[model samples]
Target chain A: MNYKASQMSQSKKPDADASRSKKIRQKRIGDQLRRLYDDVTNEPVPDEFLSLLEQADKSSKQK
Target chain B: MDDQAFKTELAELIPHLRAFARSLCGNATAADDLAQEAMLKAWKARASYQAGTNLKAWTFTILRNLFYSEKRRSWRRQQLDPEVAEATLVSNDNPSSAIELLSLRNALDELPEDQREALILVGAGGLSYEETAEICGCAIGTIKSRVSRARKAITEILESKMSGLTGNDSLSAADAFEDIMRQADELSRDLPADA
Candidate 1:
C-alpha cells in the first residue's frame, strides 16, 4: 500500500513538471515568432515599394 | 476615403504586408513581390473599401488571397520540375544555414499552409480570432483549433532541432531542458562565424 502511494506521488510530480515546461515552451515559441516578425516590420521599406506605387499612380493619371 | 488618404494608409501598411508576406512565403524576394502585388491591388480596389472599418485586416485578406492564388498557379507549373522542387525542399531541411534561427523558419515552413497562416495571423500578427476568421474566410472555432494545433507542432519541431534528435521524438520531449540548451550551443558553433 505504501509503495503504491509513493509511486503515485512520484508520478504526480512529472505531471506538474510537464505542464510547467509546456508553458515555458509555448512562451519561447511565441517570443521567437514575434521577434522574427518584428525584425521584418522594422526594416526600412524598400525603395521599390514606394516607386512601384508612384508609377501606378502616374499611369492612372493618363486614364 | 479620398484618393490621397487611401494611398497614404495603404503605404503605411506596406511594411506590415511585407512582414506577413515573408511569413507566408519564407523567401524574402518572393515575399516582397507578393507584398507589392497586394499593395497595388489594394490601391486599385480602394473604391470598395469601407472608410472606417479595419483596413489592415482588409489589406491582409487581399494579400492572403493573392498568395494562395499565386501558390496554386505555381503548383500547376511545378509539375514540370518535381525533382527540382523536391531537391529544394530537401536542401531547406539541411541545417547548414548560418543564419541565426533558420531552424525556426524551417519549422514554420513545415506547417501545412492553412495552419501556418492561421498561426501567423493570430500568433504573430496580433489579430483577434474574429479578424483571423474573416481574413481566412472560416469560422472562429476553426481558427482557434488551428492555432492550438500549430502551437503544439511548433514546440515539437523546435525541440527536435535543438536536441540531436534520434528517430524517437517522445524521449526528447521527456528529457531535461539543460541537455537541449547544450545541444543548441554545440549546433550553433559548428558553422564558421562568417559563413
Candidate 2:
C-alpha cells in the first residue's frame, strides 16, 4: 500500500534537511536489514530441520 | 492444493521462515525451534491452505503467532535482559560486519515489537505492505506508520553512536552514514514534491 507519508509529501513543499536526513536514515536501515536477512537466509539448512521435514512427509503419507 | 504441491511449497518457504524467526528471536537455537514448530503447525493445517494463495505469508503468520505466544510464555518464566540476548547472538568472526550487524540488531531490538515486526516483514522479508498488514492483523496505514517509526528510531540510534565515536571509528561511521544519506537525498530530490 502507498504510505500516507509519501502521499502527503506530494502536496507540500519538502523541508530539505528534514526530508534528506529522513531518507538517509531509512536507506541505511534498509541496507542493514537486507544484510541481516541475507546472512540468515544464506545459512545452510540444519540437519534437524531436514529430519523434521522427513517426519512430516512420513506422517502425511500415513494420513 | 494437493498434498504434494503443499509439501513442495512448504519446503521452499522454510529458509525464509527460519530467517524471519532468527530476526525475531535473536538467537539461533530459538529461531530453529520456532521455525520447526511453525513447519509442523503448517503441515498439520495444510488442508486449510487455499490453492494459489501466498504460502509464504501464511507460514509467516503461523511463525509470528508462535513467536509471540512463546515470547509471552518466556516472559512469564523470567525477564530476558536484551543486552544478554544480543551478546549471545553476536558472532566474533568478521569483526567489521559483526560490529555493524550487532549494532543493527541492537537497534532493531530496541524497537517496539509491532514496529520491528512490521519493518522486518516489509523491509527484510520483502513482503508487500498488504501482505505485511494482513500478517500483522492491522490496517495498511498502521503498518506504514510502524515501519516509518522503526526506520526513524534505528537511524537515531546509529547516528548517536556515530557521533559518540572519535578518530578512525568516526571516519568509517561517517563514510557509511554519508553514503546512505547521499543516496537518500538524491532519491528524495527525484521524487515529485510540491515546490
Which number leads on DockQ?
A: 1
Residue A8: error of model 1 in Å? 11
Cα RMSDs, all models: 8.5, 8.9
Error of 1 at B97 (Å): 14
Evaluate chain B of model 1: give its TM-score: 0.72
Across B67-151, the per-residue lDDT of candidate 2 in tens digits comes to: 7776554321122346644553464354444556667777787788898889888899899999998887889999999988888
**Against the unseen true structure, what C-alpha lDDT does each candidate score?**
0.75, 0.76
lDDT of 1 at A5: 98
lDDT, candidate 1, A1-63, per-residue tens: 699999998988888756656665676668667866876898899999999998888788788
Off by over 4 Å in 1: A1-13, B72-100, B162-195
TM-score of 2: 0.74
> Model 1, A5: alpha-carbon shift in Å?
14
The docking category that best describes candidate 1 is acceptable
lDDT of 1 by residue, B1-195 (tens): 998888899999998999898787666666788899999999899889999999999999999889888755332111113343344335444333212234566677778878888898898889999999999999999999999999889888877765555555565432334345534744453443432
- Residue B135, candidate 2: alpha-carbon lDDT: 86
DockQ versus reference, model 2? 0.40
